[model samples]
Target: MVPRVPSPRRPRLPSGRAADAALAAVVLVLVAVGSLRSLIGERQESWETTALAWALLVAACAALYACRRHPVPTATFVLAATIAYYLVSAYDGPLLVAFVVALYTVAAEGRLRMAILLAALGLLLTGAGTLLGNHDVNGVALFMMTGWLVGVVALGWVRENRLALAREAEQRAASEERLRIARELHDVVGHHISLINVQSAAALRRLRKDPEGGPERAEEALGAIKDASREALRELRTTLGVLRQVDESAPTAPVAGLDRLGDLAAAARRTGLDVRVSTDGERRRLPAEVDLAAYRIVQESLTNVTRHAQATAVTVRTEHGPRHLTVEVTDNGRGPIPLGGGSGSGITGMRERARALGGELTTGPTLNGGFTVRATLPCPAAPLAHLPGPGSAMANGEPPRP
Candidate 1:
């Protein structure tokens, strides 16, 4: 399998040419300052002193520019050169800025162990040279060196934290988007599929009863088509409500569940399919998610029968337990089942529904020369409120919640 590449997170810095220009300006300023300091008191300075000091100063500034790309190597070269200069002529100025920039780069790009090792080595070399070259190692020098190293390390730490936070936020947003898409797909597709399965069976039944009445069968098919179209419209409205704005309201309607299984079986029977439903365990009110998942599993299986399975009989079995709900739809359709043969929207939609409900779906040929779609969904402890109540509310004389 090919590895998935993660999206790049860091924003690109503006204009490399502009950065180079800025670096050049900084280098010129440093060189001019060093030259002015050298001629502070002397009216007539020796050519040797002037040439040697300015050359070393320009070399140090160039090292700073090189450090931008090759930080560790440039830092080492500059530190070594500065140490040699101090040992020979006891010259020192704002050259510490180059070392600080190099340290920051190393800390940002390298491993913690390597960054700390390089920092310790650089500090030790500079401090040792200062003490040995008769340049009094005062408190001010110690504070400045320590402060630079600390600031660079802190910057690296902050960068790492910000990157981590940004990654977490991206993952969270991706997850939310997946969920929203899943919900929209389910509502939009599930209703129409259900209506199609219903209308097809109705037409098939009418044709079986009166083989000569072709017009009647055609009319039934047309009715089924109409129902499917209306269902599609309803789902589209709901989905548009969600897409428009968070405050937009959706139409309230009954979603198919266990209660609608009987109607589904009756419709299939009308289409000449001998579909039987069996319950093996005690049935209780289940969570809306589990109920909907179970209902869709059976509906999709029946729909497949009408479309692919050239068989007469199909069975839907449901088993409810304390912690789980299991549903299986089986049919004696053909000899060999094409479990992974073709890609169809129905199959994909069913799989997505099962996953959204935190359930598992398996479909393949059975040992007895039949196809079966089985699903197991976790049952919540409490019942769903949206489900229809038992019998008529008026018969019980109970007032509905206001």
Candidate 2:
């Protein structure tokens, strides 16, 4: 399951028109507050021109406020109003603020062609006052307009990338979990079913041959089948329980791993196959993830033997080294085609289990007339060794986090 991220709530009016209207009112108030000193001062220009300029600035801000929703149109309106204001009066305060905001929105939200067109219009209007009316060339005004416009657009793009990365991480985590669950289900069901099939067929043949003592022997086979089915279903339920609501108060059992290898070998022997397990070096506890993955790989390989190999004898060997643990499974039966010949579920599942723990697996027909599967799993010196005694929080893996 993917974890959710919380976002801050922003204020907005219900309808588009109302939202624009409310924004316009706030912009008007700000303009009035900022221009109060000059509004009641000695009239440098006629009241008619002054009132017209004020109206133009208000119009520019009202349009700028909707730049997020209507980028191209709002930018055009702001450009027209700014040029009109400068043409009518010499006074320039926060009047250019709206124009810059609108330009930024166009760069951030509009298509490339449209953004280029709006940018061209912005430059043309900056020189409009000089061309259409009396005004001096001002480099300061040009710099301020260009800088703010570029800055905010870059800011918006950065925000977009960060959000995308977060979503990608969530998806990767979910996909990995799904793969893991699938592997578990396959190993459990495949192993149980193969044993059941082998035992049931044997019982049927024994009954056909010997009329007496047939019921007693067949009863034993049925009992073994029932046990295998029950165990398989119980494990399936445990694996599926993770998808349900979890309660902290209810303790959960640990996953089966090397500790259950004896049970696995016993089940195989019950199917009349001679199975043997051999280990080397000192054996100790492994990280839960590594342990579970190793167990699944071995389990899948043996299940393949019971189903396809028809081998009378099977051998599993585990070797623990300083840096890695190796597992090998071999059976003396006529080998099937190599795993890569098709989408063989046993080989595919085994490979996935090893790779999930930053390890590798290989499978092929053994020269001695059978199939063999081998895998290697790395072992860290300690679980949290890289972490600074108590405070380090960075998660580690072979490849860096995306």
For residues 1-402, what per-residue lDDT tens digits would candidate 1 score against the true structure? 999999989976545555644664586587457647566665444667566756665676677665656767876776665555554443455665655655665666544455566677767877776677656556578768777787786786567567768889999999877765765565456546655766666677767887899657669676766766676787677666766676765467666577767655755665567877776555678887777777767776777776677778988888777788888889988833366764556666677778877888888887887888888888856444454432223212235556
- Model 1 per-residue lDDT at 386: 57
Best by TM-score: 2
Alpha carbon lDDT of residue 157, candidate 2?
Answer: 53
lDDT of each: 0.67, 0.73
Per-model TM-score on C-alpha atoms:
0.56, 0.74
lDDT digits (tens) for residues 6-71 of candidate 2: 888896655676765666667667766776655777777888888888888777887756777888
What's model 1's overall lDDT? 0.67
lDDT (Cα) of model 2: 0.73
Candidate 1, poorest ten consecutive residues by summed lDDT = 389-398
